[model samples]
Each structure stands twice: as C-alpha cells, then as structure tokens.
Target: MKSTGDSKETFWKEYEKLPDAIKEALFSEENFKIVSDICEANGITSDESKSKLMKYVGKTLMGKLPIKDFFVTLELEMDMETNKAKAISREIDRKIFSGLRIALNKIYSTNIAENKIVSDNKRNKDGTEIPMPSKNEYKDPYKEPLI
Candidate 1:
C-alpha cells in the first residue's frame, strides 16, 4: 500500500485532472457536511475546520486514512474556534461516511469502476465457475382432476 503522503499526492494529481465542474462539486456544501460532521463528532470546533479537512480530500478517497481518523487529523491540524460542536452519533457517522462515499464515487466513478471490473475479471479467470441452478426441483402439491 502507498504511504499516506503518497496516496494524498496521488489524490491531488488525479484531482487536478478533473473538470472545473467537478472541482466546484468537490468544494460543495454537501461535501463539506462530511468534514463538518467529522469535526463535530471529534470535538473539533474551529473556523478552519473545513479548510483543514479539505487538505486530506485525496487521502480519504485513496483509503490511506480511515474516515474517523481523517476527521481526527483535521481536528489535530486545525486551531479551534469554539467548543460547542456536538459529538457525532453512530447514525450520523454512518450518514457522513455514506455521503462521502457517494460523493467520491461520483467524482471518480469511471476510474473506480474500471478498476473493479478489471479485478473482477482477473478473479473470475483464476477461480472455479459457479454451478448453474438445477431446474424442476419442486413437485406440485396437488394434481389436476382427470376429465
């Protein structure tokens, strides 16, 4: 696996190749919600919270950083602006991760899906085939009356 810094670098390199509309979407408010939730959950209150979170956009998508740790890192990296942010609940945590995953997929769906298709084909090539289901396994409970 690549080092965190390397993965982050890779993320930015790919990020730069994205269209301007995608770049705008990357900074969109819904995307920011993931970072905001992470910060709140980890008790990181800061005006710069979102900006700090932005720095790891690449690492998170690259899987170099766990989602929670990504937030924790942001918390550690940013100066706090307040202490009133609420802790993230488990449900909220799920939602935040779901949202991030969706957003990242939207941004890199083609590349991500291409990799998956290639890997799946390789695995199938190297593995045994699954058996097809047998037909006519069940018997009818009642027979029709003879004319």
Candidate 2:
C-alpha cells in the first residue's frame, strides 16, 4: 500500500560508503598469498576461485575472528614463508584489493537482493498464509476482490 524506494539497497549502499579502514578486513596480504598459492598450485587460478576464497575470508571477518588468528588458518592452506608472503603481498596488493572489493560487493549485493525478494511475499498481520484461488477463478487471488 505504500511505496517510495527499496530500503535494502539503501542500507547496503550506506554500509559500502564507509571508510575502507572501517570495512571488514576481508583483504590482507596474508590472505592473498594463502588463496593465490593454493589456486596456482592446484592449477585452478580463476576468478571463481578467488570469489570462493573471498567468501571464506568474509565469513571469518563477520565472525569477528582476530586478524592474526585468521592468517594462521590461512597459512594452513598456503604455507608460504612469513617473510616471503609479506613481500609477495605488496607485489600483488592491487589484485588482492580488487578481488576483495569485488567479492564484498557481490556478497552484499546478493544478500540485499535475496532479502528484498523474501520481503516481497505478502503475509497477514498475524503472519498467517491466505489460500489462493485457482487459475479458473474470475479474480486475481493475490489481490482482494473489488468491492
């Protein structure tokens, strides 16, 4: 009965507008090495793999795991020397940043889209479902019959 704009999009967009520092630390030099090395070693270097890794890191961030602990887990998969990983981190910083940024954007976008779609379902004030009329019915089931 009321319409103006999509609130879910606005909420996520507001979150995206925050300073990079405040954003979830989904991007780290250590994370990049862990992911890139594994993907390369498995001959699976691809955007899709990066996306999966991003989701993994994003989950860790959302879980509020300390940054240091996150790298420890990542190293289990990567195993690059600390010094080498740190240096390699700088070299691939741009790619790592871009991948993370894209990953977060996709995560937020899908989350908002799914929520908006779920919210579109019509429900009673008491949250009871109303049965719908069949196609043979004269009136639209989704709408109340006209007076």
Candidate 3:
C-alpha cells in the first residue's frame, strides 16, 4: 500500500490528467462549500477550512468513495440580481461526510490493530490456552513468593 504522501502525489497526478471541464466540475464551489461546512462543524477555523477542504476533497475524489452519497444535485441556477448563471447544488445528507471521516478513522485503527503483537485468540507457546487462575489458586505474594 502506498503511504499517504505517495497516495496524495498519485491523486494530484491523476487529477492533472482529467479534462478541464471534469476537473472544474469535481472541484466546484458547491463541493468547496460542503468541505468548508464540514470543517466548520468540526471546529476548524474559516481560515484553515479551504486547505482542509481541498485535502479531504482530494481524498474523496482519489479514494473514489460514493460521490452520489455526498452531493444530491448539480444544476445551474440563475442569479436574481445579475441574471447570471451559477451552479446550485444540495447535499443529500451531512452524514455522508461524517461517515467518510469514520471510514478514514477506521484506517488508523486497523493499522494499530495490525501492528499489535497480541492476537485476540490468546495461547501459550506450548499450544495451550492461557487461562486465568481462580482466586482459590492464588497465593499471598506479600507474605511469601510462590515458587
């Protein structure tokens, strides 16, 4: 598996290969706003939200998680004042990004679990299960050390 830096580099490389129209659509303002809103809800400041949004957006695009889950619509709406056209979108659900955050968290937890030496199925080197001794089998260690 590639490290995050490698994956990030690969994502950007792939992003650069996309057509201008596709790139523009994928990184549209609606998506940015979604990212910013997510960051703000999680206590990230407005100043840092843009960069963080870009990072997560890149991850989402690169990871290829369900885009439909995050965004509901991508229609053009005319601005009432200038009568100019603008992209209007609605997020289907906020839980989508929250779920993505959870998915990413699982990645970290999985790594930790994988690196652990202990297994869930505990056993001794003699191929026998290491069972907890009963209280009656215990000795008073402070009085005398057990041999």
RMSD of each: 9.7, 15.5, 14.8
Mark the 10 consecutive residues where model 3 has the least summed lDDT.
78-87
- Record all residue pairs in model 2 with backbone atoms less than 3 Å apart, i.e. clashing: none
All candidates' lDDT scores? 0.54, 0.52, 0.47
Candidate 1, residues 1-147, lDDT tens digits: the string is 569989779768887766554565566776577667666667656757546565565455544455556445543554333232223323334654455565555545655565564322222465865454355764556967679
Clashes of each: 2, 0, 0
User: Model 1 segments beyond 4 Å from truth?
Assistant: 1-12, 16-25, 37-45, 68-93, 99-147
Q: Best candidate per lDDT, number?
A: 1
Please provide, for model 2 over 1-147, each residue's C-alpha lDDT reduced to its tens digit, 9 standing for 90 to 100.
123356556545655754464364545667656667755754546777566555545554343333335444444545645654444334333444454555445545655575664433467899876655566775655986669
**For candidate 3, what's the RMSD?**
14.8
The window of 10 residues in a row where model 1 has the poorest summed lDDT is 80-89
Please give the lDDT score at residue 132 for candidate 1: 42
lDDT of 3 by residue, 43-102 (tens): 446565447445534545443433442222111111112211011112313433443445
In model 3, what is the error at residue 97, expressed in angstroms?
7.1
* Full candidate order by lDDT, most accurate first: 1, 2, 3
Worst 10 residues of 2 by lDDT: 59-68
Tell how far residue 121 is off in model 1, in angstroms: 30
